[model samples]
Target: MKISYHSPHEPNCSICKKQCRFYDSLREHLIGPLPKAECAKQFSERGCSLCLKVFPTAQQLNNHRAACQSLPPLPAISGLRPSLVNKRNQAEKEQILEESSNKSNISGIAMDCEMVGGGRDGSLDLCARVCLVDEEEKVIFHCYVRPPIPITDYRYDVSGIKPEHLMGGMPLKQVQEKIQQILYNGEAIWRIRLKGGKAKVLVGHDLDHDLQCLGLEYPTHLIRDTAKYIPLLKSNKTSNSLNYLTQSFLGYKIQNGTHDPYEDCVAAMRIYKKMRNEDHSLSATEFVPENGVYSRMRQKELEKMSPEALLQISQSDFYCWCMDSR
Candidate 1:
């Protein structure tokens, strides 16, 4: 059955990038009535029946399925059962993650913030808690925030925040200072912004909102927003929720119960790493120097271009995470 909400996190077809309300809808788009011709053809050749992921070749698909079948079921983070699936998966990935960490010079820091409602009718967002994790998914910082104004609504239904948690929470000013200091990684903010220093790349889903709630700012070029990444977006080009993106890409479900900032941080970091690790075929040299060439093209010309062609001309605007590997 197709999902009805048309959630912002709508699942996108792995092959053609068409947006669908759910996996079932994606399956329909791939192999159902009135299927997309190119996508359907590609899906039929290499798509995984279980996870709907399309592999690059028949041999890889067979190998992936054999391993996929024997793997433990993906743990649902939404369950309040206090299971170890997320942890176990993280532990398993450490071996893989270490391969990258052992050699890479990148400084990627993933963070997430929980907001509580303030002001009249509790409409204003106040930073209630925040968590930051390194590439290793190790918690570098995790603290409940003491908002300037009392939290009128803890948003506990989602945030799981309570008065007790804020009783000794870190002050907002201090939290901001700490986060900025960590992100700046000892360099002055100005130095990092001018590309003169090795500022940590901040990774998160919907970072704009989180940064706003925390009253902090960072250089846009140094930020990696998983929500805004073109490839991770819904076929309709909307941002997918962290929950959907995590389960789809990370092989686990999260944000299922009491929201854990750590879970979200880890999810965004894992997705960033996953995308970074892909063997993209395009060379940076093939791409146009900037995005201006794309805007100059007529609509029909744009429409006629293939995805690869458009990508070749969209170097400036996209600034995709994969390019960071360079």
Candidate 2:
């Protein structure tokens, strides 16, 4: 998706180029405040949309793209998972087992869940389907889950899950066990002593909700949530929707039709990988804080640190699972 840049009146950061409200200035032109050091680093190395080449100057990018060959479009992805549970069998189970078995040393896997309402008012979320994908975008596990409570709302329009779909769905406990097995690489969670362990990172958007609905818990350090990633947030410092982040950052559209957990999983993984590829480049002397208290520090304390040091100690406005991972 292309960003609209028709308005020159709108203020934008000189370094990061993100449009935002401007502060009063006598010069009538200040390109807004200087962006955080990390943001400056990112904008300086931005890739050209037309040619996929990184250029230091917008003029250079434009000139290069004018004569550059366009890259081929990626093929459409499909067969992510079945809409019905009857289609699942031993073959599918074996495929998941094989994939999980191979991930003992892998860095992380992405996950997404579809939920149905089950409370009296059909207001409580319950996990109905789950999808997990590896770094290569291969499906590690995907299955429909039976909610423990009777589903008051199948949320057919949103989730595409009907009553028939859950008839043969895996029990909630079984689904939870399978997901835990895949995430933990079959090692018991309690036995994993270190932050760096057999446990693989879990990538997703709004993962707390997904894990809550699924009734599963994972180490904070092992979760990468796109919605809470600091640099990916909107100008207002609010979390962006997964669909917006996918189209705006990853150059694709998803979740337009009835929600597909696998598609969402892939999108979340792509965003996380994109962020992971950045050169944050903090020095060993610049320590990252644990309890996320940097933002609450007094202005005097903040002013004492250099911009790079500030960036090092800064935390996401929201609870980013990636924080613990760092």
Candidate 3:
């Protein structure tokens, strides 16, 4: 007698949901033991084989592939081109000089420029006027710079330069030069005096950037940055804000509306004077230069010598010391 073996539920093709001859065959198809020829053909017809998403045309599929493999476009070469680079540089230099010349009348002006951002890409947009005071602490020069870059952030509201002010403002190069001239001229006057007597210092908080922004080179020895003297803030703390330092040292809070450059410059100078005064009062010690290998060997030999021999060598060195001092 013949017997039929059948599952109570008929097994169907996994890909198409069509009934198959045997459960084993259906299992093999579903488990992918044997490749589905029709499914493979269907996948080949569509552009995306993995997802089987079809595109209208082969060109669209090729275009998508090209896009996936393509790289981003690079920035336009600003300085390398023969046509535009030199002209741009000359324009920038002239603009800087013009601004500096315009602000020449202001005595000891302390100016700060606010830019759209901090990095190289960001352009200067606002200027904070700082009028330098005399020894009595009176304002001598004050004026805000209207920036050219559009202000996108509301945080600049405290900077006291409105959008209306910047709408018809000058280029940043001009403003930067103006600030530089004010600072450098103030420092230069004292430097010239020091040439006949003692060196005068250009004092500032994080002044390197300020000097750099102005396109001026300052002697490292003559310049003093307040940010450097306070070791605790340099090593331990993250923030070195002028506001925090001024409040801590001067016992006065910087006003919230706009940063006064004059006040900042004064604070920096005060800090520098304090440090210098402390330095001058310290006792001096003789500094010995490291001797050559032969000298070092001689030193070791001297160390091994008897007390009488060492004393004799010391006496001989007295003549050498006198010659060196002369």
lDDT of each: 0.70, 0.65, 0.41
lDDT of 2 by residue, 180-299 (tens): 888777777777755545778788999999998888888886778877765466656678899877765566687776887777877887777765654333323334333533344444
Clashes of 3: 1
Highest TM-score: which candidate?
Answer: 1
> Could you tell which candidate, 1 or 3, scores higher by TM-score?
1
Tens digit of lDDT per residue, candidate 3, span 21-112?
33234433433446477754443454342112335577776665543331211222211332232233556645644444345433222223
Q: Sorted on TM-score, highest at the top, how do the candidates line up?
A: 1, 2, 3
- In angstroms, the error of model 2 at 113 is 0.5
Query: Where does model 2 exceed 4 Å of error?
Result: 1-54, 57-87, 193-196, 284-326
lDDT of 1 at 290: 47
lDDT of candidate model 2 versus the reference? 0.65
lDDT, model 3, position 314: 29
TM for candidate 2 is 0.69
Q: After superposition, which runs of candidate 1 have C-alpha atoms over 4 Å from their true positions?
A: 1-33, 36-45, 49-59, 65-106, 283-317
Top model number, lDDT: 1
- The better candidate by TM-score, 1 or 2, is 1
